[model samples]
Target: MDKKATVQKSGMILPRDLSERSWERIGSSLRELTNSSAWWLADWLIFGEATYGWRRYREAIERTGLDYQTLRNYAWVARRFEHHRRRDSLSFAHHAEVTRLSPPEQDYWLRKAEQQKWSRNELRKAVRASLAEQTRELSPSQSNGDEKQEVTQLSESAGADKRRKVARLTIELSPGQLDYYSKVAAAHGLSVDKWVTQVLDAAERRTA
Candidate 1:
């Protein structure tokens, strides 16, 4: 069968007793430990346990003597980091080697976490939902990876040149009509040119 067909078939197949047993064991462990904790704590526990690299995380927890609360917060941060990494399909090292982040990396990830304010599981879900690769093809030196920058750099000047070559429409407006157009544009929170475009678009739609 094709890959899609196999996935669909797997989705159709109900879990057997063994799968149920494994899920029950894992779920019960999670519920028992995390039930009294905050939602974020519970999320982190689940995500950390589910994903690989628990032994290293455990060592960090053990060495630091991080209270349950601190652990919970770490989980929250990890969740955020993982979320963006997964979305971008970018590989990030776990908290090892004590390496400092570059200013841009710090700014980008911090802003990302602040914006999303994700819990542990939600962060993991975001990671899982991230694209296979980040859309922007970045060189090692570039910090801002906005793909639109490339398109803009290539297209904007050319587009402007092309636009400049086109003849602009000139229409004579009576004083009354100009006043009415201004009022309509102001009412719609548009500039006069945008208002005219919108009016033309509406007219075209009606004709169509």
Candidate 2:
């Protein structure tokens, strides 16, 4: 029990005249705790819900004094990522931003975020931009559900082996048309080929 600094479940308490070294240590400790608290709460909720069924939410809210919906959202993000899949470099908020993503995408964006040192808000913006690009690639007539599935299918189609039937089509494009498609595809982080497939698939769906 150092009189210079104290870290507790309620919050950190520090002396007014702490040494620079003590202050630095307390700051480091606080950072670790701040980063970890979400995962800890999430795992706690998951275990409690599994063990207590529906009673867990009631007891957790009363004991923790946390908002019920926030707690539920935290647990949902936790359940989306397994312990092994969780990234040490990113915070729970980063994971929360990617919860709407597909399984493969969850890993993709997390790795990008960790490597690029993106903040939670930055990740959220990037995810939103990506979704918007996909929606734009899909026509306005399609629902967000269709756009989400299109993105997931694109990711899977990239690495997957095509075992089913295939038909090849060759379309002649003007130079201007080719350049336009390339720019559109590059903006959306897609290849011109994939962009064409996405456009064609969306058109087929609209007609169907």
Candidate 3:
């Protein structure tokens, strides 16, 4: 059968003899849909259903014609970063890579992703590196007296001299406040830490 006839009969976009023009058009349309905010509609639906109950979540996923894995990724992203900043420039794949991390580690790798313009593969590598570093830091061998002392001394020296060079400041915020700041920072193409630093520096300059 011809391409149009096959599509009309089977309601399938994919056909062995599909025309190049038709294929390109379909691809473009799908890309546009994925790029639009509509892509998150499934996420919101999944979130609502999950809040109601597991049965409802499963039913909604089926009703919406979304696969479980895709819905699961959205749900995971929502729960993981519920009170954290999300970068618009980063795709869902990027967020998915860091979902297994602690909140602070999530922020650390995400910030690196933003600064480095990492592809999803690159983000995966960064996450792996971060995990390795955490594992090394938490090793029992590092807890011995001499090693602990050395670590303490090195940490103290780093804290003292590094602050002079990079100037670290600590501030506590409610979850809501942190989320808002994160959104603002991501919008400006800066991580929360870098954004806060720039804001402080700007204030200092104005005062000066």
In candidate 1, how many Å is residue 71 off? 64
Q: How much lDDT does each candidate structure score? A: 0.43, 0.71, 0.62
lDDT of 3: 0.62
Candidate 3 local lDDT, residue 87: 69
| Runs off by more than 4 Å, candidate 3 | 1-32, 35-42, 50-52, 140-208
Model 2 stretches with alpha carbons more than 4 Å out = 1-3, 7-25, 140-208
Model 1 lowest lDDT segment of ten? 148-157
Q: Give the root-mean-square deviation of each candidate in angstroms.
A: 17.6, 12.2, 9.4
User: What is candidate 3's lDDT per residue for 85-105, written digit by digit as tens?
Assistant: 676667667777888754655
Evaluated against the true structure, the overall lDDT of model 1 is: 0.43
Name the better of 1 and 3 by lDDT.
Answer: 3
Best by the lDDT measure = 2
